[model samples]
Target: PVGGELASHQWRTEHFNNPWLLGAAVLVRDETAINYNWGYNAPAPGVAAENFSVRWTGSVYFGLNTEYTFYATSDDGVRVWIDGGLLIDRWQDQSATTVSAKRYLTEGTHPVIVEYYDRTGPAVIQFWWEPGAPPSPPSVQPFEIIVDDQDPGFQKAGPTSSWYFRSVGYKGHTYWTYNSDAQLYNSAKWFPQLPQAGNYQVYAFVPKQRADTKNARYRIYHSGQEHSYSIDQSIYFDKWVSLGTYYFAANSTEYVYLDDITGEPYASKKIGFDAVKFVSTAQPGPAVTPAPPPVTPVTPTPTCSIAPILGFGQVWNTNPTVRQRLGCPTQAEISTWSAEETFIGGYMFWRGDLRLIYAVYNNGTWQSFVDNWDEGQMESDPAIVPPAGRYQPKRGFGKVWREQAGVRDKLSWATAEERGLQASWQAYNGGLMLWTQTLGVFVLYNDGTWIQP
Candidate 1:
């Protein structure tokens, strides 16, 4: 009789083989025997073996080393073997079950055989693995900066309203005023006081109909005086026009006022003002060199050993032996070894095991140099190029070497062993304290700045 329909036809019909015989007739169902088909079948259900074993050639072993999970519904049975040795064998009657196993094997090819049966529900089997699994690399953390309207010190005032000064009435609105001296203007007005001395661009929105007909005049008052400039050009009405930029000197007070003197009656009646905005155009001054504020320099709690390197002015050394001796290779990328000092010129060198490199800042341009040594022969001129400001020299040696008058002479070298001299140079003169590493160069500045090149 044929096994259940869910079983593979090939497995049910295939003959079993053993060492003693090429082919053996194995009874799948024998109700007379209580332990039928090696106790894999149930007698009450008219036992049948859905899977028949077959052997050929040498012993079969599915030599695999990885994760393998088995899934089956209603009833599931599986057995794993290596070199004719059973690794796992389970014959059970139960609900769906999932199992995972990992094993290692020899390099030679192996065989994998699985037998599964589903009595009343779905069945599935899958296996997967990743050899030589490695840990995930680190990733850069992300950040963001947010800015709002209130950050710039500006506030909005609602819809426009008309100010009446005299008996002049336009359209249905009468402009008769008891106070004749009060000037009639729009709702928008500049701040009564200027925040600080800076160039400011003012934007005003006036209706198009009024802007086209009536020529508008406006003046900006700064430092208690009205600016001589006037906005006489017809602006696009209902649109924002830069009323032009005005400069307010340090400690100056400013405001803006508008007057409608156009003789067209229709233009005067329709002229309405919307909003006004003020933006600063002042450039910030160079950062001030902060005074060394008097503070009790806390004596660091003395530790067992001093830090490996001293922090000081820029230092340059091309000895790979020194770099390795100082434990520099492991710290090439994260540490700063050299720095630029503001002096007759701005430039410095960061020494690495592979080369003697320099970072030169002439005027404001920055360039990098890579040095190539010809062993015992005379050294060739270093190749110079513009680097992406941050330097990592694992690829090769980089030296910022150029014969510009103010370039090479400016570098003042100090050693990691000379702590006092390094500290003095850092305190008095600004430059980099360089550390040479196998991967690249590291620079530390006197002012607590570090750069990797």
Candidate 2:
């Protein structure tokens, strides 16, 4: 058999091991062969030897129609696809290891893509292929099972009207549809029946026709965990795309799922529902124990604690109105309330029994009820009319005036309606009282000193 080399451009990056080949590339070069051993050193001037990634894409020529096995070896993660069919998918961090997958193809040129990343330590990667079936011993061939869309093992759900069938390619027939706007509106599941428990590489067949969705979502339920993957069906046709390998028990709980929801625009593309193949990599038999199931992560429930208060004691002991409205402190006192005030020492309190919240300002120990329900109505209500020569507080001023008896006595009577000084508010009379979010509520006396009521 004649041999041919691939004309490829390798895109390399110094960033951390990224299986997706994302981010900018640090080096790009056309190489005649896919072979490299940049051990403990950068492959290029700017690229890092470890914690880096590389992607090679090009076309390979096959002189004859036959079975060909593609091989890849890497220290960490790696994935390979030929003519849009993912053959090798060991995309994970691991020591130096090699993996290969064989596929039959006609005489022609086919596109190939290889992606690799090194996490740490010595870095290495190589790719090559031989024209022949993978050398297997005289032992029984590994067990392999494929569940077609028409098979009883293949279950489907959705409106019957949306389901359409086609007869062609690998499985003889497959189900396909236009992309759906609704989530998971159409779905198919492939449940395989294994004779024994073991690890298996799963693959989904993307048919030649009626499959055009760029984002086809597949889920594999194995060993109490569901792994998700998004495949572009438009690039693959009449080929089994690897969905990764997993440990599965010979039971009904493990299966493969495909849905119409691909986050694509409404009815813009076609989606194909076809067959799923499970190739057993582990030894088959009752004597082979199933791999331990992955540990389901446990999320810790959140908890909160209220620290003891020391600064609010002074204000609580001094003001009876604050003590009555605020009750016991819920949180500790802090210096300089927020970013606005210059005063030190303030605290927030809550009456759990009454469901009332209160706050006292540090400047003058002014009390404030933090009631959300009645605050809007109380502040916007009409002002009370003045009695004879005495004037009533206006707008928000009236609401505050009516609530505090001490304000009425100290201010005598309002001479005018509340006016705004930027974001602050004030009313005139025997004494001027200003209200601002930062100062809370306080009376500015003739001597310039303010008092909290």
Candidate 3:
């Protein structure tokens, strides 16, 4: 479609600066493209100049499985979703900023959504897409099956004394029980549904908090035999502790079991049962890819090297490739978000050449992107893919963000990126997503209900 459907563009006013599309649309019309600079003017006849939102939904046809980067530049906040997956999410009050995310799409039509909100400034928003490198052909991809504590394959037996604890567990949650004798009061089992009989490497996830049992025992029922192993959960935190490879048939009878019996004086230590993973060791088939059709070649833009900065010594010194990707420090780190009106907490770093940026809280957890500049970025290798154009939380906040699929699906994809913040907290879709040492990662919903998982 050359022009968008008139019914797809919707404009609605939000008196409270709430970016969500809670009310009915006040203005609905067609738009050729999402390129606008309202410049302190109202977006539409009835829409307000500030504290208003617009949503554009339509189907986009993709011609290849190649990578495409969607760019969204807006003032205030903006979010974009492709095929219902959130790519760029920078739902915060700021100047005109551009954020982008890359997605590999097949040759077909995919649903695209763009949501924007202007708080109180020169409204500016432009959205477009650029094709990037094509995806590699399927190769010897590792075969792995992960069964989280919340998965259907996981079961808890014995006493109901085991409790759910929110931490940096495998899938952001774990079941814990006080250590006891081998009598077994609480036990958890993970049954694997394999595709075919083969050798698999099994591993267990140990969380960082509330897990202190030194002699946490595990039992693997496979090949009609029982294999026992003891683990010291206290030594490793938020890590996958391997339990060696084993042979298993594709049946429900074989399982991995763990009990709260470590013989370490009852109630003295906590035993954590998180998630289990099974990895196939089978060799992959041969790789085959047809030749791509020849197309007109264009000269690539040359990228320059980044010069070091005094303040970014820590991150710059560690990652050598950051210099190449980001040409130079455009300016010193500046305040992004603040705790008090005067106390700077969130800081941002800009690059001189491309539309890339890096941000960090006072804790030094960094976030980088080719366009988006919120949240966390941890990889150091240049070859290691950057967010490419996404916002991912870090540490505990990341744990909760990864676990809450339903919340993210509702708030991130279905609505605008107008997450508000209040008093040392970040808000999202009428819910609070903040982290603390005492409370860990939690979400406080508008209904006064709290969830930590």
Candidate 4:
């Protein structure tokens, strides 16, 4: 054998930025069924905005060594192979559809491979399988299981909106979200744990009445970016309407969100949230989640003095959130991280092993790599300064800055607001001002002393 070492059937997963599986792809946190309907929005946190692909590999164990039927319910394109043999091959961009095949196999472990691409718009995919029952011939579809609203799979899972399962709407009964005046922020969710993980087609059974608005919206939260969709509830009553397709992660924070924007143009009309469905689509080659390389242990630190890093006299008596995130600094020194934001002193603490620890003298703000690197928030959220009655993003800066690959690429700091200022950099009301061309006006505050906003 080449190299005298067999390439183990270890699972490998990769995510693509381009829909065609070409160009370059990122290694995702995990591989999953592509059953998502991120209508008019990014797929998931850290995923591409649109046009992406996914590939996964693993070994499967066929029980009884019998022939198994496999399905691929997908939009765009998909290809599957098991034990070096092709099973399902439907490669084209189209509406959500299903295709299947039967294959004989030896029992025990066999390698499986899957590849998929989403060219545009709402995207979904699923892989499903079961013991074969043989030729249903053409024109007739095979059997599939559906997870409905009234079923145990449907769950109440949201922190933003209120909802109720009503008997007066779509198919026998429908769950509806009320008090949705907040639009994007208000949301209701439908979560059903599938029998297994793979691609699945999702549909909604919602009815619209004259009193309802036409622009009811829902967001499909799946493995990638959360999908946003607008539906006019005035038509398609009780029909099994497609809500695109998506890859749903089991036990992951994935769920469909029905927002409260019931078309304000329709004169404060109410929105409808009803039964949703998930039908089996594609089946994975292996039943196991791909494992990543073991995490390297955090290295032990060398002993160091703390007086210089702590600025002569500084206590960990402020911003618990930041303190909890960054941990106690072992050896900190005055830093000049940002040239614009002036401070009495900025401290860069070393926790070793490439850990990032930052602290500012003002209000004793500090955070470790968790809040800074993992969460990737540029500024500590709510920079709470209870001792001084001042908070981060105070007043004109109450908003949190969005995350970007780089701090400079972000549109604006979360706290800055547009006030129609003209100068590129100016001092306003005793605060530093910069009219950033990237987003909006920004004002920075730096004082050795504390003051309330």
Candidate 5:
């Protein structure tokens, strides 16, 4: 602890302006998550960052046993140690600069300590670590692709592989649960190529089939990474089941696999494979800012409107008993996704913390898509989170926001609305979490399901 005294000496200043090594004395300290940006001020208001000294000690958890490099970027003198050994020892006055040291450790916890001193001027400190070596050259190019029913990119396996992803009605065999059926094999694999690099969402045709397999396993591989997914082929039917979105480097060899060897205990059941559809998702692209026009642009009044919601709209706006219970829309109604196959327009209404989405039935009645106990959102939640909308693009299966895209050529009627719906969504993964004034948090899934998570 005697080193704490040297912290105040100019010889031990962050810049190391003096060649002499002065002793340091640790005076006061605080804990942090290693992310801080304080400019032209002390770490604490009264304490001067100049000649201020701090020491941070903690344990870093590593999931995998691998070599890691601890990096520290600071504007003053700093020292880092792992275990009982020193990795970096530049305890001298310095301007904004970064220094790092590598350490070999097992897949577990390791002790770490960071000592820093701010001599003067702006103060900045940051620390971070990642698996494997530091970031290097870019690897493969990500890809965007679409494999349709008729597209040659589609492939099947196993002796029992059906002709394609089809429902029973295609052949009028109502006996089949989903009207159509596709077959699968153990370790069955399909390879589809992409035209370029980017992130893409993989959706599988899931038609309800009571007799279908309960634990059909599927895996999607992209950009040197793969994720496993399992489905109860009986529950979700007549819908595009998402296998999750992933990034893929441009390559014709990338594949999606359906394997029978799942770790779970199940029978030797027959799995179905409608078709795997891929649609381009968000990918990093260059950004450019353009000069503003000489004249000020006029703003247009935003129009609020909902697509024709059939019977549901009439009751949502007129029903007496329902209005007394759930209340009516606080603001104007918003258009929501309508099913292309059913030709039903959906409506979203918000009355304070009471939020509801409505769809119609054959008997001209309206009902909520999902039902459950309640939770509310926090006051800090975004005013509007993108609602689930279904759109089927002509080129691919189409896009469906979980509770959350770009405008495309054609869309299934379900989520049709005026431009700019995507701009309001704050969810990164299609699931929106809203903070309500009363309830803590309410979640809306991309498939139009609600839960109080």
Candidate 6:
């Protein structure tokens, strides 16, 4: 008996029984088999050649309490019976196909009878079942961060002559603007040598502005060939969006260029670009709890938001084709959430949960890793606008906290209620904890309270 929560069941049966025997003279081939030429010559008189009979016993006792999946290359037919009960009679002239059915039977030895005929070409019948529990669905490898830039070194592709500069920003590190004419085509290249050819996605901090078709456009290039795509900024103000994605072939150099550069009145207003990040199409290795080490004390750097270290409690999901074709484990269950990606030195310290899975492309190569986050914990609603200097967390549970030398540290933690006016706090020198709230900005003290400056 195929076990589980009894998802569903179907039964059908058909019989082609003739009430009249046609042409009685049956030639015995081996005393066990007889060849009766019913359609042609030498049938005794009064023998009917064609006839049909019907009997509804309601069921057949074939005792075949097993589930079966039938496949036919050209044409096929099947008649099944269980415990002498006629269940399925699906005999029809059809093309090659596949069908499945589940049957229940008594314990011990159960009888099963299946009459399958392949009419045209390739024919096959196979059955497999989970005797007790249903098999678990396949998993996808976790997503991983392929290329990252901390500062200084990460630069944008220059004009037809100069490349964009990577600069430090109030949030973290960002790319500088192109001083060249907007109409003039320019690009910024990361120059990171990719491991293989796969689906690759590019992320960057782009200054937001009003929608103008003639304004700046974003494009990616692999092996010097322009990839087809554009960013949509109709819904956002001046903020960051995952510029979208493109394909990168193996052993190829990739770069992103901004074209149709317009909106000068707006471009001159902003100084530099945002952070640029590139990740591979491969899944990240399993999450390993890093060994504890001494906390390195350092001055608190200004942070846009805090990022939390995630645990196994997180889950995710992605396109099935990405999972099956590219060997990416679907984030369908907890056991499969293994890979991780950490975005450091940015406006927000974010991490991608599934870094091990890669999506397969139509060209047989796998695409870059597509991070799938926990829907309930992480923000999945694409419509939710991000606040100033804040972009979407890569994936998984996001925690806003302070870190000192890669170790999690608290900078005077306080409850949401204690952050209001009636709060008194002590001051500690060199402990930089700048807290910016909706109303205004303030600093935190060792006593776990806020003091507005």
Per-residue alpha-carbon lDDT of candidate 1 for residues 1-453, written as tens digits (9 for 90 to 100): 112112211221212322121344443321111111233432123323333332111112222322223222223444433222233344454454545433333222333334333232333232222232222322322221111112232222332343332222122122111111224433223443444555455555443343342234455555443432223224453454454445455342455554444333433334333344555543222211111112221222213122223422112234232222122111112232333322222334433321233433311222233333335633324343223332212121212223323234322111111111111111111222343322133443221222332
Candidate 1 matches the true fold with a TM-score of: 0.21
Candidate 1 runs further than 4 Å off: 1-188, 192-194, 208-211, 228-237, 249-253, 263-269, 282-453
Clashing pairs in 3: 100-389, 101-389, 306-327
Over 38-57, each residue of candidate 4 has an lDDT whose tens digit, in order, gives 55466666667668787766
Error of 2 at 44 (Å): 27
lDDT for model 5 = 0.42
Clashes of 5: 51
* Tens digits of per-residue lDDT for model 3, 1-453: 123122333322223234565476777775657888999998877778888888776555666645566788899898775533345778889998878665544454555667888888799988888765665543444697888899999999875645656666876788887888657688899998888776567788999987898767777777564555566789988998766556677788999998888766678998888999887754243111111112221211223122333324343344333222223332233322221110022222233222222232221122222332234653222332323233443322333223433222211211111121221233222222333333233332222222233
Q: Compose the digit string of candidate 2's lDDT tens values, residues 1-453.
A: 125232343322223334455666667766666677888987777777667888776546666445667788888888875543345778888888988765554444555667788888878788877776323432445878989888899999889999888896465898887777666678888999977777777888999999998767788787665655556788897988866566678899999988888656788998888989888764343211112212211121122132213323444355453333333322333222121222112222222221222222222222322122334465443445554544554433444446643333323343333333322222121112334454464432211122354
> lDDT of each structure?
0.31, 0.56, 0.54, 0.44, 0.42, 0.31
Residue runs of model 6 more than 4 Å from their true location after superposition: 1-183, 195-200, 207-216, 222-226, 233-240, 243-252, 261-273, 281-453
Give the 10-residue window scoring lowest on summed lDDT in candidate 4: 287-296
Which candidate ranks first by TM-score, i.e. highest? 2
In candidate 2 the C-alpha lDDT for residue 346 amounts to: 28
Candidate 4: segments with Cα more than 4 A from true spot: 1-147, 156-166, 177-186, 208-211, 263-267, 282-453
Query: RMSDs, each prediction?
Result: 30.0, 30.9, 17.3, 23.6, 23.7, 26.9
Q: Cα RMSD for candidate 6?
A: 26.9
lDDT of 6: 0.31
Give the TM-score of each candidate: 0.21, 0.35, 0.32, 0.30, 0.33, 0.28
Candidate with best lDDT: 2
Return the lDDT, model 3, position 403: 43
Summarize candidate 6's per-residue lDDT along 1-453 as a digit string, tens digits. 133221122212222323321222232111111112233222233422233211111111222223323221213454433332223445654544445433322222322334443333333332223332222322433242323234443444445343343334325444444333445544444444655555445655553432323223455566434533333333444454454344466554566555435434434422334444454434332111111111221232223122211221111012222111112111111222132222211112111221212211111111121122335654333654444433433332122222111211111111122111221111122111222223232222111111223
Model 2 whole-model lDDT (C-alpha atoms): 0.56
Rate residue 321 of model 6 by lDDT. Answer: 20
